[model samples]
Target: MNQPVSAVAGIGPRNEEVLATMGIYTVGDLLTYFPFRYENHEIQPLSEAEHQQRVTVQGTIHSMPELKFFKGKKSRLTIRILADGLLVKVVFFNQPYMKKQLILNDTVIISGTFDRHRLQITGAIVKPVEKIERGGLEPVYSIKGDLKQHQFRRFVEQVTDGFIHDIEEVLPESLMSRYQLMERKQAVYYLHFPKDEQAFNQARRRMAYEELLLFQLKMQWFRKNERQAGDGQSKSWDAEAVNAFIKRLPFELTTAQEQVLSDILSDLSSIERMNRLLQGDVGSGKTVVAAIAFYANFLAGFQGALMVPTEILAEQHAASLRELFAELKVNIAHLSGSSKVKEKREVLEMLASGEVDLIIGTHALIQEGVNFSNLGLVITDEQHRFGVAQRRTLKQKGLRPDVLFMTATPIPRTLAISAFGDMDVSTIDQLPAGRKPIKTHWGKRNMLQRVLAFVDKEIEKGHQVYVITPLIEESEALEVQNAIELHRTLTEALPHRRCGLMHGRLQHQEKEQAMADFQSNAIQLLVSTTVVEVGVNVPNATVMVIYDADRFGLAQLHQLRGRVGRGADQSHCILLADPKTEVGKERMSIMTETTDGFELSQRDLEMRGPGEFFGVRQSGMPKFKVADLLEDYRILETARNDAAKIIQSGALFEHDSYRSLLMMLESDIAFQEEKVD
Candidate 1:
């Protein structure tokens, strides 16, 4: 923590520049740049190595390498090598160029799958003797362009050997001894150039624990003070007003919705500020939960602001709330990029003068020109889409208004707690009664005519349809359907029905109008992109056809399917897929198997791992350099429990170990402050 990467011996200028690209500027960063995986290759005599195991054997070729193919050019090539006085047979599958690369009596090193019974090596990596990272177990680091694996490993070893003592201990000695974790400095030494398998495992465990501990400490601090203000008081929720608002809605609230509503109201009434994440599957009614929270805050004599990601979603929220809160007689104002000058000016005047009770908008609502007289509650939909700075800007407009974030993406339970631990999470798990589960089917793209016929039939039933593709137009690089051409084809095939096109690239007014036409039944079928996946609500749309379904993740595919089945009528989601790999095929199959978002969420985590699920960098959660939430979940539990103990003990800001913990967290604290600034 105290030394720059330049302090590391033998790190010359070119290597220093390469290391910097990987965010390894300080000795601490370089020390914590742990290997992603490891290879077991002990340098032993060939006769002593176990059978069917991979072993790195260094030797000289004893016979001429021969290339032949009895089955055209697809046959294997065989070579013979001498290692430790043993004839090690080597084979390659159809890589005939190997015969030209190595000749008889050539000294080389090959790591391959060994057939110990026959002393044969197959599917091996043959490198010149100079390039091998010779040892017992070799660590494999994640590679960047022009960063050779062996060279990077050697550089890391050189640093660890010379400067591992520079890594300060951050965990308390009591916890370290209690958990039987490796010492801090020892962990850095073992993680990079581990002495043995035992040391390697211990290093991984200790490092994973540190990442989780840091994350937990960060979240707990945020739970209390992310949007802190001197005034930590808000009026209690009006029970009568809440009941009255619920009574006005034509449909009854689902049990899940009612519970989440109660949770939000508790936070609103708390003496401390409210920081809550409202999570629900698509069509699970988080909007209504957020709506009542907004209304409750308004009843407490304060204004409310709801920020959405897209302009289209902002408009839809405004329209829906207008009707939902009609009987409440609350003055609602809406602002977006497309708002006319006069309307925008009027809305700003009302908001500044305290005439607006609740306002709905996109990012435009956070503009410096827009001032709220008394903003009490801020509900942001699609929480991941907004950065910390934007949310901080909105909070500045009010006296620490209660913050609520809603996401339709059902996060796996482990992720929900770890990533959003700072914010108390309330999930609406149950859908409204009588809402039929959507029927899902998978087919190849060659069956497009059948899908078109089905869309026409759905239109005949007085329902609209959605056709979602991944791109806006045909790309020279990608093979998937794009909006422009797909719309043309649909219009020609379904000549009797009106078709509309929408995508993010379209003009704001054009996108809004297209969505309006789809909602009003003027457009019988909407051919669009993922822009419609979230807030474009059309109850009459009963069928969803996703093109190239394999291209989407399970969570995204679930959201797209949620576009339908909103009405009382039965809905269908058809996946048109031509998957290119086993992974894609499995993802599509999972979509067809069930409609439970939470179940699909867990499955997606297993399929994509934590790095891809929710995106490690983009989810607004702190990045982990060592721990994987999905794989190292046990370590996370232990860290969280210990962190809670440390918090209860009230030693987080005291003691040498705790001092380092605070120093380690300085960057994260600075980042949060930067956003508010």
Candidate 2:
């Protein structure tokens, strides 16, 4: 089945090399490289154009465009094209080669967006009238390396032209009719060369549905297999022991926390393996809930592991837990990368000897040579920090300890279903006692002094402040805020104010020292990066100023705001940005209007679609190709149903046709489990 690369129509040897460089080799790869977007070739009349405007116009070339090079440094080509008796100016930059492509009197389709001066046709495609008819949307795919769109599209069409013929419907007929989905071949054709908006929409729906369905099926299968292989965990504990531990805390548990703890306790008592996700917003007391579960397992005389993402967070959790358990005289230890060799060996020895009731740390907990004595529960903070493999390894440690995963990032229902369908979910939406909402404001760079003054006011009140910058060290482009330089400037500008700096670049101990100083009120203000986005709780911090706020997404801005407003004192989050673009204004708008993280997350999904924003991928959740955990939620739901049906049917386990797919998934799950451990 060695096929010539040229079989994919537009790919000559030179173009093939370009595609190969981009990791595209076979015809299948060319066809599967779906379009990132579409260029509407539905030509618009230029006669409707306004003066000093760039517009799309469908017309024949009235005359051959003149080509002239300027001083040998640049070349310019201009032409007069007529559309319904209206003349439009077509200009090209350094495009003398385009003169040969634009034939005289050719009814070419020109398409480009406009600014207020000239008709820009960066994506002008000529159509020889004698070859075919026109008037449809053009598919524009993401090209790799040096591959031209024109060549890529031509090759895609050729490959798709052949592949579509052999494409059999993977979805069952019963499911297809139930969901009103088009046949696979028709969907592919319409997606590549849609005849109308309706056709495009329908095709996209089908494709999205199929992708989501596959994902849902996989998750549901995992859930079913997990449930069916039950009754391995037999340990159970007295509820009073957990209750006694809770009664010892300084602050009373919120009703929501109690309810979630009840759910956790119930899950842990079950013989079936526990796979639960506890979704809580920042400062919603997920830690207390996790602590209760850990204590419950300890009361049952089994060990527990609480894994956090950072050494700082790990140390914080271990310290807080140790203090809390000291009331009941329980033993606790922490193991992180920074732990000394003697200390690490001691912790490992205690764990193996069943002397330590609970162990808390970062990835060091997953490192080799660390053994747990009767490990009964595994809790992961900010679930995204650890992959599935990490969680699995911890669970596999003690005959599959009950797993409790917690996240402060509130995910949409659709996103949760897609990403965490295999695990049962418990949400803690209520804030704890005396927590106040952070007041949000949108300002520009010109209002810097006012924000600085406000920071001074908060400091004067004996409250600490946080000034967040998008960059940690320094960047050549974004000059408005740099934590390192700002720390120095603030130290000099406000001599009375004790300022400290914390960023990702600093050593672990340096960060810990800075944060500790800020917590002790030694630093009146802390200038830092987003390293403090999660798990850093400072009740005294009353003001947060984010520079170049436009650079951060709505959800992230919400998360940073969550860093504040934790105490009884009223807090403010000032969003400062130079509104030079429409996107900047939109981001500022989102910050002012919403205090809800979920709402902000939805808005973020809408504004940015899906791409990287402020270093966190637009999703900020997890990575998935061919599946959008947010936009394709409906498809996920449908896929879940399909997966349930397939598992119930029991045909897949026997069918050799799907044996390879099953093996691949199982192998991946095993590998993931190993990696996480």
Candidate 3:
């Protein structure tokens, strides 16, 4: 089983072990590992096969020559062959065993890179004693560990040839015909071995569409079940209380914000449980809207919990909410792992006794002993920062609380639909009045002194500065500055300057202390990582210097830029980029061109394409292998139409075609029902 014979077409047990060591074992796995590319032999005639554009040559081996060693460092074997009445040279490198496999007058089918002077046959998988048919097309697959391309391709062809008839048609005939998709069996064969580019395209389309359709079907069923099961539970808030909260805001709300708030309040008041996603750009006052929501519920004699991803952010929210609702007479509490045991015990007691109207914290809000007597609203900041389980844990604390998730990351509208199809969406596109745009500028590393001077100017004016670095640690390959190193350098450069350092490696208390110092104006400069991308607001910080701005995505840069321009004072964002590549230049260009986060997000998708921007690992958006949220907008629209049609027909539960889809969705519902805490 471990020999080279296992990979070769027909070798004995003794050869199998030799092959196994090279990593080839079962024939099936061997076959799936295809070549990266094919050397097309059809470009030139067989006579000029060696010189031909790249064609397969069919000829009889005239002689098997002796092995020759070159410079005692390399080995080579040459065979004289006749093809189409012309003589050609077939050469092999470091393959001494091939001499034993090939004989004089044997017909050979060889494939490889070819030049006019020589036929560079990189592989000798097929050595027949007689002339055989050559290639018109070839198959390629991603190489697997211990798998050689030549042997893998041949094995796949053999296995596929044998199982072609056994393949069951998973797609119905009517659907295939309607969509003009290739037959199931033919698609499997053609996908591995395409006759032409057109065939390849058809096979790819069918597979991509099928995968997306299946995922969409599953999402649709889950959404239906949720709406049906979660209906008739949401209670109304006091309208007078909500209107009064809105009226008391320091700045007037934008029309978009007002519309969103109205929709959310209405949903919360309806018989159906509220499941909504609130999307907006950075500094769009989403938190203010959330405050109004919590106030509405608070006035209705219930509690609301705002869950953030970090302790710093949770404390920030608690402070901001307090300021926003100071006149509303709402009692708010902050809870986190950092809270003292006595403090946490007191907060939990208040929560269980219905004394706390609004609570803000990180995961501590979902602690085991923390219970809510009248929890009616659940709000999560930076929704993607926390995992699915964390959100469910908060939901478990309430009696089917109305979940409101907020995110400053602007996703393409098409993606926003599918990713959050289970919930209604409210977008705040317009910024509030008096919100100033951060002036963005591009500069080189040499201009660091000028940027520092600007920071000093801001500091002299009684303002603060945030200097963001791409990395936390120093590395030889990276010429750009790092947070830790820059923090030391700047503090040294300006001896009188009080600078604070914040990064992920720091303990929670240390980070909080650093941030608190910055917030209180004790520190004139704050050097930190992108971990400060969320809801930590310092209105007094008026200058932001981002090093290696190109290294960050446009969406992230937008968030970083947002850290400034929060006060009435004019703020500036200095973007430092190396512009080493096209990608780097493109990303920086976006920052210099636009202050609109949503617009930058769209540009990022267009430049980098959606595949690199979204995935299960990054955005945790639904993973659609071939369906791009930006490019596949048409398909998503079609899926929406199809869903509406099916639902309108009222035959989803009665239709056999949807039965399997419904059953598959049961698992998602069951998973959601589990006690997360």
The C-alpha RMSD of each candidate to the native structure, in angstroms, is 3.5, 3.9, 5.9
C-alpha lDDT of all candidate models, in order: 0.84, 0.75, 0.74
Residue 656, model 3: Cα distance from true site in angstroms: 3.2
**Candidate 2 similarity to native, TM-score:** 0.88
Q: How big is the RMSD of model 1?
A: 3.5
Candidates in order, TM-scores: namely 0.91, 0.88, 0.81
Worst 10 residues of 3 by lDDT: 668-677
Off by over 4 Å in 3: 1-137, 170-178, 229-232, 476-480, 606-615, 618-631, 647-652, 657-677
List clash counts for every candidate, in order. Answer: 0, 6, 20
lDDT of 3 at 77: 82
- Candidate 3 achieves a global lDDT of 0.74
Candidate 1 structure quality by residue, lDDT tens digits, 1-677: 64777777767777778888888888777778888888765555677678887788889988887777866669688889989888878999878778888878889888888898888999977877765443466789986758898787777877777777767788878888988999889988787767788888898889889989888876666654654554555567679878888888888999889899988888888766788888999999888888888888888888999999898888899999998887777999999988999999999999999999999999998887999898888899988777777877887788777788899988887887687776778899999888999999999999999998888888998999999999998899989988899999999998999999999888998998999999999999999999998877999999999999999999999999999999999999999999999999998888989999999999998998765777755566556777888888888887877776776566886666788787777766542552211
Of the two candidates 2 and 3, the one with more favorable TM-score, higher being better, is 2
Superposed Cα deviation of residue 569, candidate 1 (Å): 0.9
Q: After superposition, how far is residue 425 of candidate 2 from its true place, in Å?
A: 1.6
Encode model 3's per-residue lDDT on 1-677: one tens digit a residue: 11222445554465456446645565533432333454443323565444434456667788776688888657888777776677767777887778887788877666555566554444434445242233355555555445566655665666566656655454445456777887656766666777777876686566555555555555555566546644636666667767777777778889998899898888777767777899998888899889888877777677999998888889889888888877767999999998999998999999999989999999888879989998999999888677677788898898878889999988777667666666678889987788788899999888888888888888999999999998889989988789999999999987788988999999988998999899999988999998888878999999989998888888888889999888888999999878899988888877889998778888877876655655455344664433556756776766666655555465556777666444444544432443111
Runs in model 2 lying further than 4 Å from the true structure = 1-17, 20-23, 42-60, 68-76, 81-94, 101-125, 131-135, 610-630, 649-651, 654-677
